[model samples]
Target: SAVISQKPSRDICQRGTSLTIQCQVDSQVTMMFWYRQQPGQSLTLIATANQGSEATYESGFVIDKFPISRPNLTFSTLTVSNMSPEDSSIYLCSVGGGAGGTTRNEQFFGPGTRLTVL
Candidate 1:
């Protein structure tokens, strides 16, 4: 199993500002994924951070807006480039788990960094 943590459990920011959240894992993981959960909405994959490579972003996300960095196997960071009330949501970092060669890949989420854009 993999454990993850995100910084700034909650933050209130003014519009036009940006915030960078850090994620740390207790163990080495092959794929580190970032997600965003809007109020009353399901989680949306932001990007997948593969070690020693550029992050692969999902549909509707661009690197300019949400830049990601995976410096090593156990650490990564995500930065929300610009601020807006619409951007307010809970950001999460996750990793997969399980046994055998098959990736049992269950996403273990952080408590989430709740952002409130004012």
Candidate 2:
């Protein structure tokens, strides 16, 4: 088990701007992922940040728009570029439990970065 933390729990951004959110896990995790949740909508997987490789973005999400960086297994950053009213949403960072288990693993999520684009 680990403690996951995100910075700037909530923020108000201007149009055409950008916000970078950081995620720190207490210990090395097997996997790290980023997600986005629109108002009144369910969570959408943004990408999976690899420890040493480029992040894998999901459909509809591009690297240029949502650049991710995972310097190590314990830290990652996600930048939401070119913000707009439609980009207003809660961004989340999650880390999977460490290895060495045969049972199902649970991913722990950070509080989340809430951005309201104006």
Candidate 3:
């Protein structure tokens, strides 16, 4: 199993500012994913970060607004750019738990970074 952690457990920021959240894994994992959970909503898949490649973002999410970097197998970062009040939500980092890093595998989530835009 992998132990995952996130920086800035929670933060309150003003509108139009940006916040970069970091995710670190204790062990090297093959597939990492970024997700967003809006208030009272289910988790939304933001992007998939594979080491040595550009992140693949889901629909409704763009690299311009949410840039992701997978510098290594054990770490990744997600930056919310030019954040607005609507961006206020919980952002999470997760890694595939099954062999070969497939979607069928279970996902281990990091203690999310909560952002509140004022």
Which of the numbered candidates is closest to the native, going by highest lDDT? 3
lDDT of 2 by residue, 36-114 (tens): 9999999999998878888989999999999998988789999999998999999999887453221137778899999
Per-candidate Cα lDDT values, in order, are 0.86, 0.88, 0.90
Give TM per candidate. Answer: 0.92, 0.92, 0.93
How many backbone overlaps does candidate 3 show?
0
Model 3: how far residue 53 lies from native, Å: 0.3
- Kindly report which residue stretches of model 3 are placed more than 4 angstroms away from their true locations once superposed: 97-104
At residue 102, what lDDT does model 1 achieve? 20
Candidate 3 residue pairs in backbone clash: none
Residues 29-113, model 3: lDDT tens digits? 8789999999999999999999999999999999999999899889999999998999999999999846244345678899999
Instruction: Give the clashing residue pairs of candidate 1, or none.
Output: none
lDDT of 1 by residue, 1-118 (tens): 5667889888999989989999998888878889999999999999988888999999999999999989988888999978899999999998874421226756677778999999
The best candidate by TM-score is: 3
